[model samples]
Structures are given as structure tokens and as C-alpha cells.
Target: MKQKIAVLGPGSWGTALAQVLAENGHTVKLWGHNPAQIDEINTYHTNRHYLPNIKIPTSIKGIKELKEAVIDVDAILFVVPTKAIREVAKEVAISVNTKPYIIHASKGLEQGTHKRISEILSEEIPESKRQEIIVLSGPSHAEEVAVHDITTITAASEKLEAANYVQDLFMNDYFRIYTNTDVIGVETGAALKNIIAIGAGAIAGLGFGDNAKAAIMTRGLAEISRLGVAMGADPLTFIGLSGVGDLIVTGTSVHSRNWRAGNLLGKGKKLDEVLENMGMIVEGVATTKAAMELATSLNVDMPITKTIYNVLYEGKDIHQAAKEIMLRDGKVENEFS
Candidate 1:
């Protein structure tokens, strides 16, 4: 059945998703904070600043007002940045009149509280106003998904039916969806992989070979799994799409904002400068601090995350950070290693 969906945010990922929904025969209201961008989307069917040279479906309505986009919607897809999720959800809570399906594709834990996206949503939106919170995550990149490249991802919720419902919403030949019940693992894996991607991008920026990137990614997954397991997520979920799959694409892809940020850092640009130049949110930067705090509190040892965190937050030299990872005490390559 066709549904009225509100896709929050007009960034690349959100625009891509709104286009997908519009193409799938749904009424899509893409809400954006930027008035100029909304005007561009509505008048020209293009978001040149975000998705350059890409034509958005004219069927998708660009909404500047949050209340207008969400009121009476059948579902709300939150694609805003991690930090912006709460503010956007707060607006939706007061505007929506129905118990819409709440779906978030954003990844990252709250900085100090370490609350996952779903947890934050649960706290803001009363149970009477929403269905099970669903997270859509995996290795898929917005750039690739925007171009209709073959891609696969996972939709997870505590309830199987909720996950299935989301899977149906996004599933298509080019964009496939797999359902999982491991929300913790999926969300943690989604957030943690961004940190590792920064490290991998730094390695690439430092002129490292494929072997070095391979090691960083492999060890990165180990640490990601460790932290996820400590958080009560299924160990196996770390190996699935949300974990290893996401790590592969985000760590290696040039389209990744996190990887691009790390690349800039490796090339000697400061955090503020790199972020300012990128013109997009590098989720790994904020997530590094959040994950570090969560890992420390949980007593989960994540060497890669620690090293990356040091380089990102402590102002440690990138070269020195690489050396620290290499010079660490010898250990096995198993899960615990």
C-alpha cells in the first residue's frame, strides 16, 4: 500500500532516500532546514549543493516546515545528523497526529549519555505516538544508492514485524533490505564503523599500502565486535552487513565523509579545518568521543578506537598514532586478540 512518508533532512542521504520513496509510489515530503535548498528541490528538481548533477524526482515534495512535513504522515524517516536527531524528533513529537512508524538511518551514540538513536527517540516520543523504532543500516553509501547501484542493507528492530515493515518499505532490485532483530548490534556496528573508517582513511592519506588498510579494517572489526558484545549485542551481528559490511564500504570509499575527514587529517589538516572544508558532518569525529566513553565505561578494550580517538581528540600526531598501533604488545589475531 502507498504511504505518506516524511523524510527529515535534505542532505545527500536523505535526498537519496526521499527519491527512493517517491519512485516507489509513496508520497514523500522531504523536510529541510535550508530554505534555498528546499526551493531548489521544489523548483528545479535538483539539490545541487548536496547531490550534484543528480535530478530528484519531481513527485517528492520539498517541505521547509517540519510540522507540515510530518503531520499526518504514515512514517517518519529520520536521516538527520546524530546530534540533530533529538531536535528534529522533538519537533515531530509535537506536530504528528498519528502513531507513525519511526525509522532512523542516522548512526552514532549521544556524546555524553551514550544513548543509541532508538533510545533517544524512545525518550523523546511517547510510546502512544509511535510504533517500534527501526534502524536501517549497512554498508550502502548514499552516493551509490543515489545512482541506483546494487546495494544491500539491514533493517533492525526489537520486534520482527517492525523490521519486516521497514524492509518492505526500502526493498527493491537495486536496493535490497535484510531484516534483523539485533538492533543493538546493528546500531552499534553502524556507529563504531565510522571511527574505524577514519583510521583507514588516515592510513590511505599517509600513503599506506592495501596491506595496511587491510590490517586496520580487520583489527577495527575486532574492536567493534568487542565493544558491541560488551553492550549486550549479538556477537554474530558484527560479522553481518551492519558490522563488517559497513566497515568495508565506509573505510574504503572516497564518498565517505568520515574517511574523507580522516584523509584530510592524515594530510595535516586540523579537525576544525577539515570539518569546515568537507561541508558535511563527519560522524566518526563525534562518535569517536562517544564510543570511547562508552567503551571505557563498559571496560571494553578497543585499541583501534583508542588510537583513532587520540589522534582525533588528543591532537596526537597521525604518524605517531600509526606507530602506536604497530608497536603495541604482540597478540593473537582472534576475536579477543
Candidate 2:
């Protein structure tokens, strides 16, 4: 059934998802803060800064006003950064009259509170005006998804019906969506993998071969699973699409902003310089801090995350951190489980 959906945020991920929804026969109100970007999408059907080559569907209308996008939508898909989730949700709460399903594709933990995106949404948006929140995540990259490359993702919600609703909305021949009921596991895996991707990129930037990259990826999964399990998530979820799958793509692919930023840092660029050069949110940089704090607070052992955090924030030498990671006291391979 075709329905009207509001896609908040016109970044690469937002625009690509808007395209997918439009192709799936939904009327999309693609909302962005910048009037210039809205005009570009409305006039040229192209978000040149984000998805430069792909032409967006004319069916996707660009809306600058937040209320205009949410007033009559059946669902709202948030593709904004983690930091902006609360503000956006608050704005939507003021505008929305009828309850609409809230789905977030953004992956990252909040900086100070360390709350997941869905939690932030729940806190900001009144329960009376929103349906069960859903999270859409997996290995897919916006660049590839924009080009019609085959991609698979998970739609997770506390309510199976909600997850199935998102799955039905997004599933197609090129894009596949699987449904899962483990919201905590799904969200934790999604947020934590970006940190591992940074480590993977640093390994690559340091000129390490496939062996080193494999080691980082393996141990990265171990630490990710450790923290996730400690935080009340299913241990097995780490091995699924949102966990191992996302780590592989984000860690190995050039399309990942976190990996790209880590690569620059590994090559000796300063964090500020790397961020300025990338001109986009490198989520892993922030997630590294949040994850490290969470792990420390939970008394979970996450050496890899700790090292990456130090390297990114404390000006620790990357080589020394890598060396320390290699020389850490040995443990049973399945200790995390």
C-alpha cells in the first residue's frame, strides 16, 4: 500500500533512503534544515554535496519546514545525526497531530547521556503522538544504495508488527530488509561497529596487510559483543547483520566516513584536521568516546575500544597503541561469550 512518508534529514543516507521510498511508490517529504539544499532537491532533483551522481526522483518533494513534513505523514524516517535526534524529535512532536510510526536509520550513541537514538526519540517525542519506534540498520552504505547496488539491512523493533511494517516498506529485489525483535541488540551493534571500522581503517592506513586487518576485525567483534552483552543485548545479535555485517562493510569499504577519517589519522593527520578535511560527521570519532565511557562504567573489558579512544582523543601514538593491543595479556578466545 502506497503511503505518505516524511524522511527527515537530506544528507546522503537520508536522500538515498528517500529515493528508495519513492521508488517503492511512497510519497516522500524529504526535509532538510538548509533552504538551499531543499531548493536543490526540488529544482534539480540532485543532492550534489552528498550523492553527487545519482538523480533523485521528482516524486520526492523537498520540504524546509519541519512541521510541514510531519503534519500529515504516515511515518517519519529520521536519518539525521545522533546529536540532532532529540531536537528533531521535539520539533516533530510539536507539529504532529496524529500518531505516526517513528523509524530512525541514524546509528550512534548520544555523547553525554550515551542513550541510543531510539531512546532519545522516546524521551523527546510524546508517547501519545508516536507509535512504537523502529530502527533500520545493517551493512548497506548510502553510496551503493543510491546506485541501485544490492543491499540488505535489518528493521528492528520491540514490536514485531512494526518491524514487519518497515521490512515490507523497504524490501525490493535490490534492497532487502529482514525483521528482528531485539531492539537493544540491534541498536547496540549498529552504534558500536563504527568504532571497529575506525580501527580497521587505521590498520589499513598503517600499511598493515590482510592478516592484521583480519585480526582487528575478529577481536573488534569480540569487544563489541562483550559490551553489547553487558548492556543487556543478546550475545548472538553481534554475529548478525547489524553487527558482523556492518563491521565488515564499514571497516573495509571506502564509503565509510569513519574509516576514511581513521585512515587520515593513521597517516598522522590530527583529529581536527581530519574532521575539517572530511567535512562530514565521522560518527566513530564520537562513538569511540561514548563506547569507551560505557565500557568503563559497566566494568567491561574492551582493550581495543580503549586503545582506539586513546589514539583518537588523547594523542596516543597509533603505532604504540597498536603494539599495546597486540601485547595485551592473552585470554581465552571465547571469553566474551
Candidate 3:
């Protein structure tokens, strides 16, 4: 069945998703704050700044106004930055008259509140105006997905019916969606892996080889699972697509903003300078602080996360932080036991 969907945010991920939906035969309303971007998408059928050289389907309509985008949509996909989740949800709540399925593809935790993107959406959007909240996440990147590269991801929700609905909406020849009920595990894994990715990028930036990167990724997954399990997530979910799968892609790819930011940091650039140069949000930088706070409150020993947080926020030297992580007391590999 065809449906009208509102895809909020005109970033690369959002644009790529809109294309997918349009290709799937849905009427897509692609929303953005910038009128110029909206105009470009509407007039040229392209979002050059975000998804350059990619042609947006004519079925997708670009809308600058938030209310205009959500007015009669059957579902809303929040693809904005983590910080913008609440603000956008509130606006959507005010705009909609009927309940719509809420789906978010953004991956990050709120800075001060330490809340996941789905949590922020639930809090800000009135329950009366929302049906089911679904999270679509995994190792999929917008750049690859835009060009129809084979990609797989998890669509997780407490409601299996909702997850299946999202799966049906997105599944295609080159795109695959697996349904899961572990929203906590999926969201936690999606947000925390970026911190580890920053460390991986740092390893590359410092001229370290694959061994160091592999170690960081492995230990990083351990820490992510520890904190996630402590917070009521299923332990096994961390090994799945949203967990280890996401960590591998985000930590190693040049397409990852967090990894790119970490690379600059490792190459002797300051945080502000690195962020300025990238001209995009590096979610791991903020997520590192939130994860560090959450780990301390939960008494979870996340040494790698702690090290990354210190380097990002406390003026600690990256080399010293890396050394500290390397010199931490050795123990049995299976800390989960």
C-alpha cells in the first residue's frame, strides 16, 4: 500500500532515505530548515550539498516548513541531529491531528540528559499523536545507500507489527531490513559505537596499523555491551547488526563524521578546529561525554570510552590517553562473566 511519509532533515542520510521511500512508491515530503536546500531539492531534484551527484526521485517533494511536511503524512522519520530531536518532535506534535508512526534514524544520545534519540521523541511528542516508535539503524551509510550499494539494517520497536511495517516499507533488492524487538540494545549500540569509531580514526590518524584498530574495536564493543546490559538492554543484541555491525562500519569508514573528527584530533588538531573544518556534526564527541557520565553513574568500567572522553573534553593529550588505555590493569577477556 502506498503512503505519504514525512522525512525530516535534509542531510545525506535523510535525503538517501527519502530516495529509498520514493523508489518504493511512496509520496515523500523531505523537510529541511534551509530554504535554499529545499529549493534545490524541489527544483533540481538533487541535494548537491549533502548527496552530491545523486538524483532525487520526482516523487519526493521538498518542504521547508515543518508543519507543512507533517500535516497529512502517515509516518514521520526524524533524521535530524540528536540535539534537534526534541525540538523537531515538539513541532511535529503541534502539527499533526492524527497519530503517525514515528521513526528515527539518527544515532546519538542527548548530552545533558543522556537520553537516546527515541527516548527524546517519546518525551517531546504527545503519545496521543504518535502510534508506534521505530528505530532504523545499523552499519548502513548514506553515501553507499544512495548509490544502491547492498545494505542491511535493523528496524527495532517494542511493537513487532510496527517493526514489520518499517521493514516492508524499506526492504528492496539492494536494501534489507531485519526486524528486532530490542529497542534498548539497538539504540544503545547505535549511539555508543561512534565513540569507539573516533578512537579507531585516531589510531589511523596517528599512523597505527590494523592491529591497534582491531583491539580498540573489540574492547570498545565490550564496554558498549557492559553499559548497555547495565541499563536493561539484551546482552546478545550487541553482537548483532546495530552492535558490532555498526561499530565496524562507523569506526572504519571515511564517511563517518565521528571518525573523521577523531582523525583530525589525532593529527594534532583541536576539537573546535576539527569540528569547524568538517562543517558537520560529529556525534561521537558529544556522545563520549554522555557515555562517560552514564558509565560513572552505572559503575560500568569503560576504559576506552573514558579515555576518549578525557581527550575530547578535558584537554588531556590523545597520546597520554591512548597510553593509559593500553596500560590499564589486565584481566580475563570475558568481563561479562
Q: Which stretches of candidate 1 lie over 4 Å from their true place?
A: none
Worst 10 residues of 1 by lDDT: 328-337
Which digits, one per residue and each the tens of the lDDT, describe model 3 over residues 9-78?
A: 9999999999999999999999999999999998999988888799889879999889999998889999
Q: Which regions of candidate 3 are displaced past 4 Å? A: 335-337
- lDDT head-to-head 2 vs 3, winner: 3
Candidate 2 — worst ten consecutive residues by lDDT sum? 328-337
**Model 1 — TM-score against the truth?**
0.98
- Model 3: which ten-residue window has the lowest total lDDT? 328-337
User: Which residue ranges in model 2 land beyond 4 Å of their true spot?
Assistant: 335-337
Tens digit of lDDT per residue, candidate 1, span 1-337? Answer: 8889999989999999888888888999999989998999999999888888899899999999999999888899999999998888888899999999999999999988899999999999999999889999999888788899999999999999999988888788798999999999999999999999999999989989899999999989999998888888999999899999999999998999999998888888899899888998889999999999998898888998999889888989999889878998888777843
Residue 222 displacement (Å), model 2: 0.8
1-337, model 2: which lDDT tens digit per residue?
Answer: 9878999999999999999999999999999999999999999999999998889999999999999999888899999999889999989999997799999999999999889998999999988998989999999899999999999999999999999999988988899999998888899999999998999899889989899999989899999899988988898888899999999999998899988988888888888998998977888889999999999899988888999999988999998998988887777888475
Better of 1 and 3 by lDDT: 3
As a whole number from 0 to 100, the lDDT of residue 73 in candidate 1 is 87
Q: Against the unseen true structure, what C-alpha lDDT does each candidate score?
A: 0.92, 0.92, 0.92
